[model samples]
Target: MSAESLERQTRSYLSNNVPQIQEHGGFFEIQDVDDESGEVTVAIGGACSGCGIAPMTMNAIKHRLPDDLDDVSKVNVTRAGGPRAAVMPTKTEEMEEMEEYKDYSPPF
Candidate 1:
């Protein structure tokens, strides 16, 4: 199947299987689809914008999304901007970086 066709099918499948993705205030956006690799990169939104569980959602998409769609090999998700956003990709590179574990110790 064509790349566009495969992507459309993947999205439709996701919507149907995970309607909660939208109803629960989560939405998925298709960032890009590579025809050669059959990989689909997506972005999360709404309640999933910065949710801690977003990673699980990504795993879910990776495993579940391709089951119902053909030619879809993998699913990738990137958070827009929130608590779960990546440390470097959001334009915060110039800011002083702290090692989370540097001063971390048992308070007990």
Candidate 2:
């Protein structure tokens, strides 16, 4: 139950278990596993980066990681660049949409 082993086990289990992840070219890397705090930090990248249902993916990973693992107390699936990209439709986006409508006219 050493930290290194736990980290390896987590990485291996996730890659082998989630068929959907594999099919979509998504993979999880164990960034860090703290034996003292039982925190497993994972970096989920590739197709999962821009996936619409990434939250669900993370949740599934969280729930599944601890089911059979004795040392995992917290499963943190970190989506690369998620925070910056998850913002609501920006003003620039709204302006772009408005531009498209500028050239539009009614048949009447």
Instruction: Kindly report which residue pairs in candidate 1 clash with one another.
Output: none
lDDT of 2 by residue, 22-83 (tens): 57766667778898888898877667665655555666677678876778888987765544
lDDT by residue for model 1 over 3-105, one digit each (tens)?
7887788778777776766876677777788888889887777676544445555556666666756688887766555553333323222111334322332
* Deviating ranges (above 4 Å) for candidate 2: 81-108
lDDT agreement with native, every candidate? 0.63, 0.67
TM-score of each: 0.65, 0.68
Candidate 1 ranges with C-alpha deviation above 4 Å: 81-108
Model 2 sits at a Cα RMSD from the real structure of: 12.6
Tell me the alpha-carbon RMSD of every candidate.
Answer: 9.2, 12.6
